[model samples]
Target: MDLVKFFHMNGGVGDASYLNNSGLQRMGIMKTRRIIEEAISNLCKSNIIKYPKTLVMADLGCSLGPNTLLVGSMVIDEVAKTSQEMGLNPPEVQINLNDLPTNDFNTIFCALHEREKKLNTEKITDVHYSPPSCYFTGVPGSYFGRLFPAESLNFVHSSYSLHWLSQLPKLREINKGNVYLASTTPESVSKAYYEQFQADFLQFLRCRSEEMMVGGRMVLTFAGRTTEDPRGEESYYYLWRPLAMALQEMVSEGLVDEVKLDSFNLPWFTASPTEIMKLVEIEGSFTIDHIEIFDVNWEAWKTKKYDNDNDNDASTDDNGVGHAVAKSVRAGIETLVANHLVKQ
Candidate 1:
């Protein structure tokens, strides 16, 4: 299987959409912004840490642009409000936005331009607003070594990213004969998903541990699964298996080459809150300030009732067949087949 090409197509598509969609961007930004605010609020209340006017914060997998600006603006505003109440000066915020080199830089630059216009109009004379610095970079491989100076950041954030590993597992390692087939069951897929999540997450925390100030905080949010099924029947399988079948059907219809289908697999994985918490426990660098799980409307699959409360009804035709079919297949391929194809 040509893993690089497959990722370039599938993974690239997902990241592009994430950065371009305003609705999706808003949802992610608002959630992370709230967490940052709350964490700062708690720190202030305890008097454990004082709000520095010039705080350094970063969005590790900061896709496009507005989301990064959203975070930066929120941090500036929060510090301003806190300082006013505490009789301290508002701190200047240094926002570092990081993402893969393949991400859309043009769109990000445009978004930053718009944010700059807004900030200029506000003209809050009491404080200085510095243009946020942006870096095009990847994590895991990029972060394991040192990217930032020691004890340089006050907070770090990532969203809907990091579940993606530096590289997908080798196909030969799972099923030597045919790389295209489902080499592992759904349950096995779920377990492997969590295992990778823990490893990558720990690596991330450990790297951040060195960069973050002693009392620095981090908040991350991403897609996750809830079922304990080995085959991942109730949760992601419903979306994936159909896609695999669809690809098989496509091959039979001569719509695409069997070789391409064989090489393709999901590019990302989802984790349950329990699985995520366990990784945090093991890492032991940062305490759980708060963790919340809520339903994410992915515009695919019918919602269903299950033990994990994550099931979706397959009967609903809310989005038409074409979109429904494509979305369902993509979700399955990205989250299920590709991520857990091999055992960790």
Candidate 2:
């Protein structure tokens, strides 16, 4: 399957839409606010006197949801505040929101009015304060390749996106019964997945290197494993085993073909911090300013109150936990699973 053409989070503003079901992703974005503010502050501090008049930033893999522009807005506000504090005029802000060709860019455009209102409202602590002009552009493409001109981006923010692979690994009949790296996955299959991640991540750094200006900053947050062992039993690897089990159960009940189940695999891999360090070193494009490993209770996040009330059907109550999680997973990969299930 051409994942680039077909891969995208579930779009639209409905019960099952990524917009409503992405409470977990929203939480991840919150964790990175301090880091992002620090990066933007540095950007303004370094170039306070003689920087360019326009500040360009991007949110890679900015799928449809409140989060599509959430972090981008935060960065815009930060740059304005930091520039003003340093006694410099706020620069024009151009935000590039990027995702696959199939993503919901229209929704992003629609939300701009409200975002602008909030930005304008928040900047008015004093009548004399002036907020910077903010502009939005939708850049639709894969981040695995270049999507911007040379040295155009000033600050980049990506939240909960990097672990996704450019494509599925060459399974070659390996990992036959599983859809992702799992405890039962063979050593060879595990090696193949890691090899694919290494290649894709290196390419990502290479493209970003050319797109980012000198001394630009990026704050990235994605799932990762701290263990030295790539094949080790980590929570992320274990998280998908239930889906494999469900498919197998359906097969036992003659609800789905075993062949179909055997042929499916998700394009995802979680690299350790050291593995990322090596890739950054090999790519020779960017240096790691700050990196850390943090954990979330995958189960607990589901129960936490979402940022706003929407009839997402991703219930945070105890009784609806399983249904909520299923909705969340569906919001991410319903199309992929539907195609796999119905394909001849």
Candidate 3:
């Protein structure tokens, strides 16, 4: 399937929409907020441009949601706060919220004006309000390639986005009977995934390197494993394993074709920090200023009980896992499923 045509967060404010089921992604943004703040502060303090009159920043893969603006607000707030502390004037913040062309950018634009008003009131002071301001724009494209002009960006951020490959690697014959990496997945399949990640990530860094000014900072936090192996326990088992099982059950019940399941593979890959560092070395564009890891439970966003609360709770199963996982995954990839697997 062509991900560019179909890979989008379930659009609108419907029940299955990304805005409704994106609590896990929101948690990830919150976890990495401090790092983003520190990066912005570093940009402000760095001698590269000495805090230029206009500050340019981009949030890559900023899909439509309330959390989409959360970090944008933080970046603006940090710039204001850091400038005040340093006794320097705040620069006009030009923020570009980027995602795939298929993303729900209209929803984000609709909510943006009100969000700007609220953030300005809360984060900025009246002295520089008339001149030094914050502007928000949407840039729609894949981050795996160049998306901005050369030397235009001062900071870049991407959270929970890099794991998605530009497209599934061309190894369908080797990775059979699974939509993602499984414990039984062949070594050839794993190698294909790793090679794709290396290529994608290297391209990502090269593009950012061209776009960002010297001494610029990019704070990225994505789904990655600590181990060298891509199929390690923390990487896939926590989520995709059970999701694949659910699909397998559907196949057994005759709702889905077994052959289709055998042919379909998700365009997602988790890389180790070592792998990422090696690629950064090869690309040699951005230096690794700092790195950290944090874990969120699979069921971190699930409510204890649903309103129905009957024998079968769609919020959670007997083991208290799949319901939330299913909703979250569906929010992200349901479009692909509808376009390719199901007969629409």
lDDT of 3 by residue, 127-201 (tens): 653334878899989998899999999889888899999988878455665678877788888888888888999
Q: Which lDDT tens digits does candidate 1 get at residues 29-68?
A: 5555667787655544444255554567777766553454
Locate the minimum summed-lDDT window of 10 residues in model 3. Answer: 304-313
* Local accuracy of candidate 2 as per-residue lDDT tens digits, 1-344: 78898888988888788887887787777777788889988988888558669999989999976777778768777877787787777889899999999998888788887776776677465764656888889999999899999999998888878998888888654677788877677888888889999999889888999999999999888788888776566834445777778889999998888888888888888889899899889989888989988775556666564344243334454656677777788898888888787545
Off by over 4 Å in 3: 117-132, 303-321
Instruction: Give me the candidate number with maximum TM-score.
Output: 2
Sorted on TM-score, best first, the list reads 2, 3, 1
Q: How do all models score by TM-score?
A: 0.71, 0.92, 0.89
| Alpha carbon deviation, residue 3, candidate 1 (Å) | 8.4
lDDT of each: 0.55, 0.81, 0.79
lDDT comparing candidate 2 with the true structure: 0.81
Query: How high is the lDDT of residue 149 in model 3?
Result: 94
